[model samples]
Target: MDDASSQSRPSADQPNPFSAVPIEITISVGKARPLIRDLLKLGKDAVLPLDKRVDDAVELYVGERLIARGELEELEGDQQGQLAVRLTEVADLQDGLG
Candidate 1:
């Protein structure tokens, strides 16, 4: 009898069945550090300064592992004004995610 939970995965030579699986990619533009006293004094509109400038390439990560670096861009046409990433550097996945 075929066990539903024991189905075999596709061989390496076959098409990857998990290709459509979704993953969360985090974008790290920069970080800010503020004193606890200053943090407590925040009001309606607060602008925390980041270490990087607007043109700096942002780092992409899967969990804590850095995966790639890319520049921030705006979408055009139907997706106008939406944010997107233009990958500048990609990690060697064979080595690892970082």
Candidate 2:
């Protein structure tokens, strides 16, 4: 076989770099406190309270583990809001969820 034909042969042990990585993402959860009756009665100026406090850091859970905490903030230019997490420790890429 020629050099080109030899090189063209596929290797069995080669790893595919295009393989997708597994990543687990968790959003901050908050409870909305409003009765069904109250929810129906809500009109223009109705104010419903949440279970979490304003100063409290929002909890983020990846699968079953509590990964990190962060403060919610609204983006200036964009309409969508964002969360900035203060990472306590670097998550183990191999052991932990990607």
Candidate 3:
């Protein structure tokens, strides 16, 4: 006999209802910590140094969780070029969510 409750519950192969929900994905280029005094001294063209080099892979995050690594790219089109990240390495699902 088939179980009615089993049919109502989501199967392992089935897509989750939350999957359709929107999530904010962020690509972290780098990080910096400036003191209040230093931040206040910033000029119009002030440049703050980051921990990462230009060639370093950028971190992709979903909320606070690290998801993937990618390289920065420029989308060619209009007068103002749009910046984007090209995925290089994907995180393993078992490690977390890929």
Which ten contiguous residues of candidate 1 have the minimum total lDDT? 3-12
Instruction: Answer with 1 or 3, whichever has the higher lDDT.
Output: 1
lDDT of 1 by residue, 39-58 (tens): 99988899999999999999
Which residue pairs does candidate 1 place in steric collision? none
Number of the top lDDT candidate = 1
Clashes by residue pair, model 3: none
lDDT tens readout by residue for model 3, 1-98 = 89999887788999778889998999999998999899999999999999999999999999888889999888886834788889988888569645
Candidate 2 per-residue C-alpha lDDT over 1-98 given as tens digits, one digit per residue, 9 for 90 to 100: 46997575656786444546776668565779687998999999878888888767666777766666666666555655654555444445457533
> Candidate 1 vs candidate 2: which has greater lDDT?
1
Using all chains and alpha carbons, the TM-scores for the candidates as numbered come to 0.83, 0.45, 0.73
Which prediction has more favorable TM-score, 1 or 2? 1
lDDT of 1 at 69: 96
